[model samples]
Structure formats: C-alpha cells, structure tokens
Target: MKIEIWSDVMCPFCYIGKNNFEQALEKLPFKNEVEIEWKSFQLDPTLDASKPQSTIEYFKEKKGFPAEQASQMIAQVAQMGKGAGIDFNFEKALVINTFAAHKLLHLAKKHGKSSEMEEALFKAHFTDGKNVGDVEELISLAEKTGIDNDEARRALTSDEFNYEINQDIQEAKNNGISSVPFFVLNGKYAVSGAQPAEVFADALQQTYKETASPFKDLSQNGGASCDTDGCSI
Candidate 1:
C-alpha cells in the first residue's frame, strides 16, 4: 500500500500527525510493505525567509489568542507529544518559512533518508528551536542525517527540488486539501487532521483490506500498482 501525506514542517499538527501515523503503521502487519511519501505543503508562503519569528508570538498573532491561551495550547500539544514519545519545546520554537525545508526533503528522498531527515528537521525546529530557513543550519541538519554538506549546499542554492515541492502543493490544492497532515491512501481513501494513533491505524487497516485483500494473487501483476484499482493480478 502507498500512503501519501501532505504537510508542513512548521505546522505543529503536522508533526503530531506524523507521530500518530507512525504509531499506527507500527501496529499494522504489513508495515514493512507499506510505501509512504511525504508531500510538501506550506502554511506560510508569504513568510520572509530572511527573518523568522518566535513560535509563541507567531501562534498568538495567527490565532488571535491571548498569551495565556497560547501557552495553554502549546502545553496541550506538548502533552500529546509526550504520549507519543516525543519531546516538544514549544517555548523555543521558531516560526519560519518551510519552503526550503521541503525542497531539502525531496533531496533527502533521493538519498533514501527522507523520513529520517524530516524527523530531524522537525525536532530541530520545534524542540531545539533552530532556524530552519537558514541554509547553513539546514546543511548541518542534512549532514547530521548522513547527507553530504556539499550536496546539501547544492540543493539549498539550486532550484533542483523546488519544482517538486511546488508540484506537491499544487496537487494538494487540486485535491481540495486546505489543511496539513492530509493522508491519501491508494488514491482512493483520504483522512485529514492530526487524529489519534488508533484512528490512523483504523484507516490504514481498513484501506489495506479494501485495496490489498482482494488482490492476493501477486504473480500476474507482480505487486505493481494502479491508480484506483491498486495492485491486481
């Protein structure tokens, strides 16, 4: 089965949904057979890459919530992350443009470490409060994730993966996706929002049965995929 997820790195719910979806995958019997793709979606396209703001202030301004309410909201999200075995430090987070980060993600995908790089970027931005929009910082992150610094720099400066990211965003718009953490299963099933692990698990299993169970014969199709019919013999 193939699962395509459209999300933004700066979006808190995107990371939350990531953790939840990962847990759900772990519970599935065909976890190893599942192919997952992370598509780019920017929440702040107009954000200046040169100067990023602090997470708390950004949240306050965006939500029009008071400081106390914003803090409580962060606390609530942190509590939820704790349950998913993640440590989120919303106090130290940076609110920046995620377009470059998404570009690097496609580069990482070429190196077969897209998911690892994504997790590292999320932690660096949300927990360590690193400036994700900075090229040097991003290069450092890529190097830490086993990608070469030169490759990272090249990707940062080049327009190589920018088109891919834009394509994802455009496709999401075409699919009527107005939110982050949108999951599309086998192009036939879609689940939105940062749902609980159980919810994701249910979606995965249900989609799996809907797509995989009926096509148990693998010899004819050899596991190759189709858009709507899935892999069929």
Candidate 2:
C-alpha cells in the first residue's frame, strides 16, 4: 500500500501528524509493505526566504492576531506536539519560504531518502530552529539523510527538482487539499488534519482490507483436485 502525505516543514501539525501516523503503522502487521511518500505543500509560498521572521511575530502581523493570542495559539500547538512526542520550539522557529527545501526533498526522493529528509527538515525547523530555507543548512540536513554533500550542493545551487516541487504543489491543489497534514491512502482514502493514532490505524486497516487479496481458500487438507484430463478425490 502507498501513502502520500501532503505537508509543509514549517507546519507544526504536519510533524505531529507524521508522528501519529508512524505510531499507527508500527503496530500494523503490514507495516513493511507500506510505502510513504512525502509531498510538498507550501503554506506561504510567497514568503521571503531571505528575510525570515519569528513565527509568533508572523502570526501576529500577518494573521492579525494579538501578541497574547498568538502566543496562546502557539502554546496550544506546542502542547499538541508534546502529545505526539515532538519538542516544538515555536519561539525559536522562523517563518521562511520552503520552496528550496521542497526542491531538495525531490532530490532526496531520487536517492530513496525522502522520508528521512522530511523528518530532518521538520526537526530542523520546529525543534532545532534552523533556517530550512538556507541552501547550506539544507545541504547539511540532506547529508544527514545519506545524500552526498556535492550532490546536495549541486541540487540546491541549481534549479534541479524545482519542477517536481511545483508538480507536488499543483497536485495538492488539484486534489482540493487546502490544508496541511493531509493524508491520501492508496489514492483512495483521504484523511485530513493531525488526527489521533487510532484514526490513522483505522484508516490503514480499512484501506488494507479493500486492497488486499480477495481470495479465501476453505478447502481441507488435500480435498479434491480436478484437471483437464484427470480428477482425484
């Protein structure tokens, strides 16, 4: 089974959703058979990457939220992060354009390290408060995912994988996904938001059941066999 996740690195609930999804998968019998592909979705595609601002400040200024309200909202998200086993430090997080980071994710996908790359990017932005939009920082994160330094640098320096990034964004739009942390299971079932582990597990189970083999043999021991020219009982 294939699971496509549409999320942005800067989205707090995306990280939490990823954690909850993984927790659900860990207890499933067909965990190894599931393939997870992280798709890019930018919450603020026009944000200036060169001038990153504090996440709280961005919420206050851009969203028209008061200082106290912004802090309260962030605190609520941080509490949710804790429930998902994530240490979200929104105070230190910066609101920067993730276009370059998304491009690098496509590059990592080529090396079969997209999942690892996604995790690293989330941690860098939400936990470690690193500048994910920076090429050098992204290269360092890519290196940690087993991507070669030179290859990562080349990919980041050039427009490599930009098309793939745009394609993912367009696909998300085509699917009418207006939110982050959206999950599409087997391209058939859609689960939105950062739901609990039980929700994800139920979705996984239902999708698996629908996609699994339909045959169920009830014959005992050696029963009877029939062929074109011979029959045995």
Candidate 3:
C-alpha cells in the first residue's frame, strides 16, 4: 500500500498531521507494508522570500486578520498540536516561499530520505523558527537529513524539480484538494485534515483489508498425487 501526503512545511496542521499519521502507522499491523510519499504543496507560493515576517504579522497584514484575533487563532492551533505531541511555536514561524524547500524534498525522495527531510523542514520552520525559504537554512537542514550539502545547494540554485513541484500542485487541483496535510491512500481513499491517530489507524486498517485479495492455487498436481502415500504402484 502507498500513502501520499500533500503538505506545506510552514503549515502547523501539516506538522500535527504528520505526527498523527506516524502514530497511526506505528499502531497498524500492516505498517511495514505501507510506503509513504511526501508530495509538495506550497501554502503561499507568492510569498516574498526577500523580506521575512512573523506569522501573526502575516495573518494580520496579508490575510486581513484583526491584530488582536491573530494570536488567538494561532493559540488554538498550538493547543490542538499539544494533543498530537507537537510543540508548534507559530508566533516565531516565518512567512516565506516554500518552493525551494519543496525542491529539496524532491531530492531527498530520490535518496530515500524524504520523510526525514519533511520532518526536519517542519521542525525548522515551526519549532526552531528557521527561515526555510533561505537556501543556506535549507542546506543546513538537508545536511542533517543525510543529504549531500553541495548537491542540495546545486538543486536549490538550479531549476531542479520545478516541474515536479508543479505536477504535485496540478495533481492536487485535479483531486479537488485545496488544503495542506491532505492524505491519499492507494489513490482511492482520501483523508483531509489533522485528524486524530485513531482515525488514521482505522483508514489504514480498512484500506489494507479492502485491497487484500484471496489466495488462489490454480496449478495441477500431475497425474497422481498423494500426501505421504504411494500412488499408482
């Protein structure tokens, strides 16, 4: 079974959702049989990478949230994250373009380290308050995930995985997805949101059970066959 997750590095719910999904996979019996693919999705593709802004400021100035209500909204998300074992310091998170980080993810995928890269990026932005849009910051995080630093820099400087990122976005559009942390199981079942662990566990169990096929033995046993007995003497 395959699980594809479309998420943004700066999205708080994406971090929480990742925790929930990981917990679910841990409890699932068929967890070893499942492969997780992290797909790219930018919550703010047009965000200016030159200037940095705090989440509260971005919400109030860019998204038009009232100054007073921004913290409240972020607090609600933080509280929700607590339940999923994520310490989301959204107050310090930066509002910047995630395209470069997404490209690094594509590189990580080729090296079988996509999940590690994803976790590092999320923690870098939401927990440690690192600028994920910055190539140096991204390279540092990539190094921690066992990615080659020089190659990572190359990927960031050049136009690598640009089409891969766009394809993921186009696929999201085709699937009618407009949210971060969106999940698709076997390309058939969809789960959208930072749901609880049990919800994800149930989906995994149900999908694995439903897709299982019955065993069949259609081979012939020759002219004569017997179990621990002589035949056709």
Candidate 4:
C-alpha cells in the first residue's frame, strides 16, 4: 500500500501527526509492505524565506493573538508532542518559507533518505531553532543526516527538483486538501487532520480489507454495454 502525506514543516500539528502516524504504522500487520511518500503543502507560501522571525511573533501577527494565548496554544501542542515521543520547542521555532525545504525533501527521496531529512528539518526548525529556510543551514543539516554536502549544495543552489515540489502542492489542492498532515491511502481513502493513532490504524485496516478481494473483469463477461442509455444489466 502507498501512503502519501501532505504536510508543512512549520505546522506544529504536522510534526505531531508524523509521529502519530509512524506509531500507528509500526502496529500494523503489513507494516513491512507499506510504502510512504511525503508531499508538500505550504501553510503560508508567500512569506519571505530569508527573514528570521520567531514562530511566536509570526503567530501573533498573523492571527492577532496575544502573547499569552500563543504561548498557551504552543504549550498544549508541546504536551501533545511529548505524548508522541517528540519534542517541540515553540519558543525557539522560526517562521520559514518551506518551499526549498520541501524541494530538498524530494531530492532526498531519490537518495533513500527522505524520512531522515524530513525529521531532521523538523528538528532543526522546531527543536534546535535552526534557520531551515537558509540554504547554507539546510546543507549543513543535510550533511549531518547522511546526505553528501556536495550533493546537498548542488540541489539547493540549482532549480532542479523544484517542479516536484510544486506538483505535490498542486496535487494536494486538486484532491480538495486545504490543510497539512493529510493522509491518502492507496489513492482511494483519505483521512484529514492529526487524528489519533487508533483512528488511523482502524481506517487503514478498513481500507485494506475493502480492497483485499478481486472481482471478475466485466470485459471478460462481455456484459451489455450501454453508452447513450448509461445502463447495463
């Protein structure tokens, strides 16, 4: 089965969702057979990638929420992350345009290090407070995560693999997805939001069962074809 996830790097819930989904996958009976694909969906694509604003400030300005409210919200998210065995340091978070980050993720996929790169980028932004939007910083982090520095530098500097990033975003929108952490199973079943592990597990199980059987080919049976009437028996 193929599980495609649409997520943004800056989304707090996305990081949590990634952990939650991984936990659920670990418990699945067919976990070994599952293939996961990470897709890009930027929450805010218009923001400048060079600016180094804190996440708190970004939230405050965008949502017009007071500092205390923002802090409380972040604290709640942090608690949730802890439950999933992930650390979230919202205070140290930076507001970044994740376009290049997502592009690099696609590049990492080719080298079989997409997941590692994804987790590293999240940690760099949310935990270590590194500037993920910067090419130099990203290259350094990539090198630390088993990606070759020369390859990383080339990928970052060139526009190669950019179309894949845009294609992911466009595909998500075509599927009526307006949020991050969206999961699509087998190109048929979709579950939105950072749902609990049990919920995801149940859905995956059900979808697997639903498509487990094979049906006879209508063409082999040569059933009556009706195009104009749109009916067959």
Identify the runs in model 2 with alpha carbons over 4 angstroms from their true place. 214-233
Off by over 4 Å in 4: 214-233
Per-residue lDDT of candidate 1, residues 1-233 (tens digit): 99999989998788889998998899888999898899999998988899888767887887688888888888998988888777898878888888889878998999988889889999999889899999999999999999999989999999989889989999999999999889999899998998999999998898988776665554754554666756553
Question: Compared with the true structure, what per-residue lDDT tens digits does model 2 show for residues 103-184?
Answer: 8889988888888888899999998999999999998898788889999998888888888888988999898999999999
Candidate 2 C-alpha error for residue 54, in Å: 0.3
RMSD of each: 6.4, 3.7, 4.6, 5.7
Query: Where is the poorest 10-residue window by lDDT in model 3?
Result: 214-223
> Model 3, stretches more than 4 Å misplaced?
214-233
Residue ranges of candidate 1 with Cα displaced over 4 Å? 215-233
Model 1 lowest lDDT segment of ten: 215-224
How are the candidates ranked when ordered by lDDT, highest leading? 2, 3, 1, 4
Model 4 clash pairs?
none
Flag clash pairs in model 2.
none
Give the least accurate 10-residue stretch of model 4, judged by summed lDDT.
211-220
lDDT (Cα, 0-100) at 117 in candidate 1: 86
lDDT (0-100) at residue 121 of candidate 2?
92
Positional deviation of residue 210's Cα in model 4 after best superposition, in angstroms:
3.0
> Model 3: which residue pairs collide?
none
lDDT of 3: 0.90
Candidate 4 local accuracy as lDDT?
0.86
Flag the better candidate by TM-score, 2 or 4.
2
Clashes of each: 0, 0, 0, 0
